[model samples]
Each structure stands twice: as C-alpha cells, then as structure tokens.
Target: MRLLPWTGAGGKPCYLSTDDPHSPLSRLADDIEALHLADAAGVLEGARAVLDDPGAGEHAVRFALARAVESLGDTLRVAVSRGECA
Candidate 1:
C-alpha cells in the first residue's frame, strides 16, 4: 500500500531512509536480483521443487536465500560508508 502519509518508525531488520537507498526492502530486492543474475547458471533451478514442510530443509533454503540478499545489502552499506560505492 502506497502511503498517502505513512509514518511508522521502520523496524530494524531494515534500515529506513527518507531516500530509497536507505530502504531495506529496496536494498534487499536489488541484492537478491543481483545474486540470482550473477550465479553460475541454474544453481538455484531446483529451489522451486522443494516441498514446504516444518523441517529445516525449507527453513534452510529460505534463510540461505534471504541471507545472501542481506549480505549484499550489508556489502553495499559498507561500500558506501567507505566511499567506494555510488
């Protein structure tokens, strides 16, 4: 939902920004897309075939994906902080 006047302190899994670069969601999406693009072709092709279950298999798969994306965001944050990223 696009906010007409949204006002909520962005909770910490993401960094909030008045600018989009500081938005964790934006950063996460970009990182995931990049990781998926930069892979050695079809590495993740079987992710879709995994069945949903209470076992750690599903959680592991999901957490790994999310962690990879978050790592990218973290890298970007560090890069920007070091004045190395645009």
Candidate 2:
C-alpha cells in the first residue's frame, strides 16, 4: 500500500496497493512528487529574494507564504507516501 499525495473529497487519505514499483499509479505518484519538489525549490528561491529585498510588498510576502505552505504539504505527502512516518 502506498499513500497518495492528494486527499479525497472528504479529506481522507488515498492509497494504492501495488507490489510493482513501476506500475502506472506509482509512476504517476513519482511524477507528481517530482513536480512538487521542483515547485518547492523555486518557491524557496523566490521567498529568499523577497525577504532580502527591503522594498518587498505585503502582497509578495503573502504569496510567498502561501506557496511555502503548499510546498510543505506536498513534501509531507511525499514522505507519507514513502512510509516515512512512524
């Protein structure tokens, strides 16, 4: 059983049962995880630049914060999917 990155309609965790790591579902999950990680890296770079700039506006800060939260969630989901949680 492998946990999925996204939740169900009712906020329940989604799982896939597959012994083959190269299954279609597994590949899909890998692709999503890669995308999330890439997004997180970009967001972190942008956030750092925004924070370093004294003239940064409230809107830019808020956007960076929101993106950070999303990235965190995505990272956590990937961890859960890999059974990293105890």
Which one wins on TM-score?
A: 2
Candidate of highest lDDT: 2
Score each candidate by Cα lDDT: 0.47, 0.87
Against the true structure, what is each candidate's TM-score?
0.34, 0.91
Error of 1 at 48 (Å): 17
**lDDT string, candidate 2, 11-46, tens digits:** 988888989889988898889889988988998999
Looking at candidate 2, what is the lDDT of residue 80?
A: 74
Candidate 1 TM-score over all chains jointly: 0.34
Q: Candidate 1 — which pairs collide?
A: none
- Summarize candidate 1's per-residue lDDT along 20-62 as a digit string, tens digits: 6547665665565455445513333334333343454857787
For model 2, the stretches where C-alpha displacement exceeds 4 angstroms are none
Residue-level lDDT for 18 in candidate 1:
44
